[model samples]
Target chain A: MSIPLALASGTGRFYKHSAKIIRFARHGCTNRPFFHIVVMERRKAQHQPVIEQLGTYDPFPNEHEEHLVAFNFERIRYWLGNGAHLSTPVAELLGIAGLLPIHPRTYMTAWRNRRAAEEAAAKASESGADANKAPESKEGGSGTS
Target chain B: MSFGSNLRMFANKASLCCNVNKVTLELFSRCSTVAFLQYDKDPGPSFSNPDVQKLLKSMTRVQLEKVYKKRSVSDNTVEYKFMTSEQLEKQFRKAAERAEKLIQMPPIVKVKEDSQKVISRDPALTNFSNTKFVIADITYGVNSSDRKILVRQTDGTLEYAPLSIRKRINQIYFPHPGRKIRLPRMFEPEHLNRCLANFQYEFILDRACVQFDPYEKEYHEITTKVYNHINESKRFDDLRSTRHFGPMAFYFAWHQIIDDLLYDMIKQDYLKNGAELVALYYQLNGIDYDKSIHEKLETLVQPQSTIQSVLKPKASDDMHEEIKNAIGKSAEDFTADDISFEFIETFVKTKALKKVQLELALQALRETNDEKKKLYHGLKKAHGIS
Candidate 1:
């Protein structure tokens, strides 16, 4: 049997060696809900120690509304360039902030409903036209002008 | 009481009257009786000298009356015009009627028991009815204990008598320039006349010690307000239980209940006037507080919080279970990006983790990576690691 691609790469046959990069994660809480962006190893436990805390997102309306989200965009961009994966919620929040492309999974429920409605309308129009043609053809044999 | 001593006393009175006001001095120098007396070659006449005795003795009653009428020299330039016996009687009567109308007299105020020395008991002349003087004509002896009330004489000497002397002899107008006499604590005037004296004067509360009656309507009003407030609030019940600490101490102890805004207002008022808060607490339902009892009251009143409640040396199994559940949920709740030191500290504290267990947990989370070592050190530093 052929060796697995991951093992081949580790064996230095197919791909060059790659360094392990720590991923950024988000922790969220309510009661003056705030989000923390923390850097950590992928292999480590979610609650394990972090390499660094990038910034915070406070969605709650505090004394000022404009200060809802605060982040080191330069650091976030650096990490993103370094192939750091964003947590699902973090990706969605960033998408809403216009900082990144809209996350594919962010509005799944709304998108699904819109698609279903469009399909239903097209089917209804087709069925109505077919019913009209069938009746006209059947009646033309009986009442040809 | 001898003639020489009496002459010396009259000299001292003359010197005092001369020293009092320029207006009175000019009047006395111009007076026909004093003009006849030979004055020593001094800046002011040396009435204190023995030579003035002959002139003083030879002075007629009518001439003496003229000096007395013009002798009024208060701290202010208060002048008293000479009046005939009929005019003096009418003026004294008018003053008595005015006092009766203005002063809120207690229907029957007790003449203080100890005032017998100063308040002569000869009812006919010394009774309250006859004992009326024009306030302007009355000059006080500065020494409170002496209880000497002097009326200025026409010759610029003082007559030591109660106000009734004016009713007794119309021709004798006594005025002197001795220091203004405060109202005696023993003499309870029926009238509350603000115009009679300065309201800023503080009366001695101890009636036995002072000659003027201390049971003034204004003083009575303040003391009553404080007493009533203490009675109603019952906030000072503990302080009152001690009995040694007076109502003032009790009022001071109740400061904790006062809110910040009210306390600020009270503080401002207090700085403006020392007894503003004291008066305010009595008048309004404002809180009275003294900072001295803050720590004691805090210990006595506040309930212990959760962290303070965690006192056991040994960790309970239930506590461990709760902490493990909380940590597990917190770990699962987030995608691996966020780890909070504060949350971990709180969780460990809630478990009532032993010092050894805390050390073990901290060691488990300690970073080994070279690049992240600085961050790990920072976290530890925040947790108070040197």
Candidate 2:
């Protein structure tokens, strides 16, 4: 049987081609709502699906802890193999979560290191300037005989 | 009867009604004018006049007596009460007994062993030539029981030794020129702002990576289009061109890419889990990725996405249209590279579509130029045939 590219139910919707899913829990924490995306098998039930846990997506803070929607990645891959699809939003989320690569280049670590170095250099320069100013003011007051 | 005699009778009556104590009566007699005067003005005579009757009722007899005596009425029956000889003798005996008990009582003031008074005078003059002020030396005797610094003010009155004075005097006397007040190193606003901006870029880049799923085959086409658009704009070049490799440029470049990706996601519903996708964006951006931030972003994007989904509006809706129109009108003044379609799009979306319409109209003008060339070539070929 051909795998459906996308599937939608009360929990959320998933797009097979994109390998993403958007899961919105109807009831869990108090009155506040929650949503999540889990990669799972096409044939498996969303809540009981076999997959890897990636992360959680919570909407309301007033609710209990369980209202949060969590994702397992291994389970998601299993579902993807079984022909599960992800929705567009879920696909983007996966990309942001680092499950998928969105940008052509990754400069996260390099950028952080560069920034730290710049901050250190700036701090050093500022301290040096302050040190130089103190002596200059002292020298101005005292002229050689 | 004379007003003085009348006042005296009134005082006796007032004393009987109020149950005044002996001491209180004596005090009142000494202070009140009525005690020295007698008053026998028959209130019955005053009763005939309504005003006098009202005044009499309002002003108690004792009060009236006082008023009459104060006016110097001489006929006074009130005699000042004095202690009799026997009563004086009894009071004297009681006083003697109280004095005896006081003398007999054991000493109530106990001398503590550790009680020592310390006199701290300002060291006649501060010696600030070379010594540094030690906080420990000043604060040492402040809370101790043995050390008491009696501070005599200029007026010779002793003021409790001020603890702060000791510290101030010590500092002035022993000045530390090299004593630096070290403050915590803080991030400069500009630098921090730049860092935050760079962090935002990284975050955006991370979000783009997730959204586009650069590794995925299906996302390959969309990623290429976005990359091409970014490269064409030389947006990344601006980031690299800076002499300083501060993450700010990278951050801004990433921000642009993420915005494009988010725009795509919103339009296409590319990410199945929109909230999670946004959360990831926040995480990579170095944002707290807390529930509130997600909720806020959700509120902003969700409605926009809903509108886009139903209307299927072009990506131009995401751009501010006002800036686009401004650029279009002034296009002659700007270089081709300076014109940002993305900025124009943002302006059009935020301001109005008129500018975008104008931009399209300008493009049509370019198209017409191409048409003229085609026609010219055709006419030349026809002339050659003839």
Candidate 3:
């Protein structure tokens, strides 16, 4: 077997006091959901004691047809200035929040959804056109054409 | 003999209420909770008038004992004081002032307008995200209410965040105790009715005031439903002397359903508060009342006597004797206040929806007052109070 690129020393490879990361901690009940935006040690599992809570996010839409997210950007800037990394979901959220550049995954998902919707529309129109032609022929209006 | 008959009537009424409660409980979740007290003309300007403010304040009938009741302190800053008489008096005055601020009523007004107005649009920004982004400004020194919450939509329109989203974001940044991002399950109609049936009006209204702003539809829906239950159960006493009493009074006056509340007031010998209730109805509806009648009710309050003072000379720890003294004192106090009786009589004649019901209750009150007065006089004669 090919050797792994990195050494297998657990303590050396992953330092005890690794870089800090901004991430989500799962909250809320089944079927219902919520998240807390937290700053924590990079090697720490979720729900472990965190460095700080930067914000919260509600994935579901409210009565206003909007996803609600709250970020203490002042703290966010402080953590980032001190070199805290961001998880992919946090990065995506901040991208839409207009704090960071838009994430590439967001664009990719949007494109895929759009493509699927357009394909559905095209198929519907093609079938609709065939139905129209058949009905016209059965109605005996061929002379007018 | 009259007291025995009264107890029987009370029992029948209690059973009637239980039957109604059973029916309501058996019913499944009804359609959407309908909003109540939707004034076409904005109640805002009217509520701001000083007269209206005074009426609401007096109607609240704050009891210092309840307001300053000891509860667990949320923080570790609890203080104990040992002060001289003067210092203690000063401290109490300061506490009363703080209590005034705490019980200040939330504004009653028309529904709030939509805040999610489009600001700008960019087709290029479309397709980058599938839902609106809610961004809050966390800059220090900004008041929570005035903080900027903006939304960038998936379809490339940037707009100000709506009230719901703004409220949520604020609650997250500065979370209120006993409030959550999602409405607590207890507020659902089925559960709320159960709580209401248990006469938990004060708790529900208190939580609602914390959870919702006055002008929101949910706020109106919840409070009005609670008020309806209170009216149905005739449990106005459960809210008395608490901050909710004023708003409940206001709701009754607004909806023209003051007969039950007024009846309760008359039975409890709070005729002055009852007059104030009628006066509030007139004020809210902008009715032109005779000034003389208003002055009459004002003069009536001067002779207001407490049951405690009349019994003070012969005060005993015996519960039965205390109740007898209360009955005698209430009879004397009731007959002495003719001005309030007259004003309330005029209200019953002209305004109350169920006039005969109120009339019979009024007659009953008068008859009971007369009997008690006779009994008290007989007792005095037997003792030979020359």
Candidate 4:
């Protein structure tokens, strides 16, 4: 005798013209992260079975340090044309692919990171000068001596 | 309708009690000074060098049962297989391959900090959305670490998202079990010391490794805190034989506080391991040690580090001596205790350690080695074997 399991799967039932969203379904073991981008009914939970898998997003860096993503642009464009709403993450990906404008937050991060790096560099040089007079201070002035 | 309201009240009461438990289960952390990497200098990158990595892996002393303990398998299906002797051997080989994969500890790199890069400032797109939109490049074939993530702010700035937001985006798509979208209660400043006080070193280290990227600042803070506590308490063996030992040992060595650890290693009769520790110290400080002894250390250390085999091209290159002053800058702090004059002619006779730097390294190895040798022979002699 066989019993049906309740694991998340596509039910193979959907209204033909219903709204959908392309997004990720989490997969992989604890501490090991992987994702499958799928087109599913807009109202369903993320783990719900989807109409089709469009791509995968692997957040862990490969040895080459690339966050690999695999998606069918044709299928993605088709879904978009058919009035499927794009999730923020999906929109971000498309932006990176030259399909849309670069996300504004990416610009913000680049600037923030740039500022942090500059501040660190400046601190390093100042600390180098401080090192010149450190021997006199002798193990730093700490505690009420 | 009354029954529904009653259920809602019960739920509300249950949630309130849970919040109370959370609030009372934790307290604020003391702003205890960090001992490891306290000088605004990185203590971990020292481990990236092959030699310290080798020593760390050896010190960790991997025991398969502890490292590869069974997980709660989600799959309930069970299949039985009949196999010939040869087939069973192949199965064992496959299992061993998986074991090798399990012990690969996370790498320690300086947190990746980059300068601000402005892509564009389109005020026209201002007020496009009140909420921020995080965009991740899902281009197939890019490594996750290198994959660029961008975000759009409410003020019409389309630039790179900060590391915090990027980590959130990563977790949204690829969630790690037990990792929360927001900071876990244990990681809050008030709760951190409470967890550390329980000496939950292994659990804290393991969770942090999974929850944060190795290069993230939070990861370093948590790891360094644990290492410092272990050092302060003289409980150096707490992280031993686990993946945590790699970074912890490197932290001690880089910070030049290996005196206590060296004493322990020597006293434990892990002389070869002690020698490797010395080698690590010398390498970090550019101490001119005997090259042949270095080779001996290489032979002594079994290559159990499956993760580092590829990252170790700088075996003999100590060209970074200028910045390596942090190591070995302080005088030896541990005493040369219980090592009889007898060792000067035998173990320390190898001249493997420099007289100036090593009065500390050779402190207790000979005594322990003799003790173990005598014990081994006594067992043999009791059976009438010469």
Candidate 1 lDDT tens digits, A1-145: 2212221012221111233233333345335445555544455554445554554554444331222333445566766777766777667545434457645664453345445555666666667669776433322222111
Compared with the true structure, what per-residue lDDT tens digits does model 2 show for residues B156-206?
Answer: 122343443332333333443432122112123354345444433322332
lDDT of 3 by residue, A1-145 (tens): 2212221111223334579888987777687778878887788877665667777788897776668787878889998998889999999888777678768876776667666666666666667668776533332321120
Deviation of model 1 at B52, angstroms: 82
User: Hey, what RMSD does candidate 2 come out at?
Assistant: 50.1
User: Which stretches of model 3 miss by more than 4 angstroms?
Assistant: A1-145, B1-37, B68-102, B292-336, B367-386
Give the runs in model 1 whose Cα sits over 4 Å from its true position: A1-33, A59-67, A109-145, B1-386
Best by DockQ: 3
TM-score of the B chain in each candidate versus the native B chain: 0.18, 0.14, 0.74, 0.65
Q: What does DockQ come to for candidate 1? A: 0.00
Residues B234-353, candidate 1: write the lDDT tens digits. Answer: 332222112111222222312211122122322222111112222223222233334233233224323222222223234555543344243332112221112222323333344221
TM-score of chain A of 1: 0.48
Q: What TM-score does the predicted chain A of each candidate obtain versus native chain A?
A: 0.48, 0.35, 0.76, 0.75
User: Any runs in candidate 4 off by more than 4 Å, and if so which?
Assistant: A1-145, B1-46, B68-97, B137-143, B146-148, B297-386
Question: Positional deviation of A41 in candidate 4, in angstroms?
Answer: 16
Interface RMSD, every prediction, one decimal place = 44.8, 29.7, 2.2, 9.6
Rank by TM-score, highest first. Answer: 3, 4, 1, 2
Kindly list the per-residue Cα lDDT of model 2 for residues A19-102, writing each as its tens digit: 443342232445654453544445555554324333345444322111122345555555556666665545533433334542
Count clashing residue pairs in model 2.
78
Q: What lDDT is reached at residue B354 by model 1?
A: 36
Docking model 1 quality class? incorrect
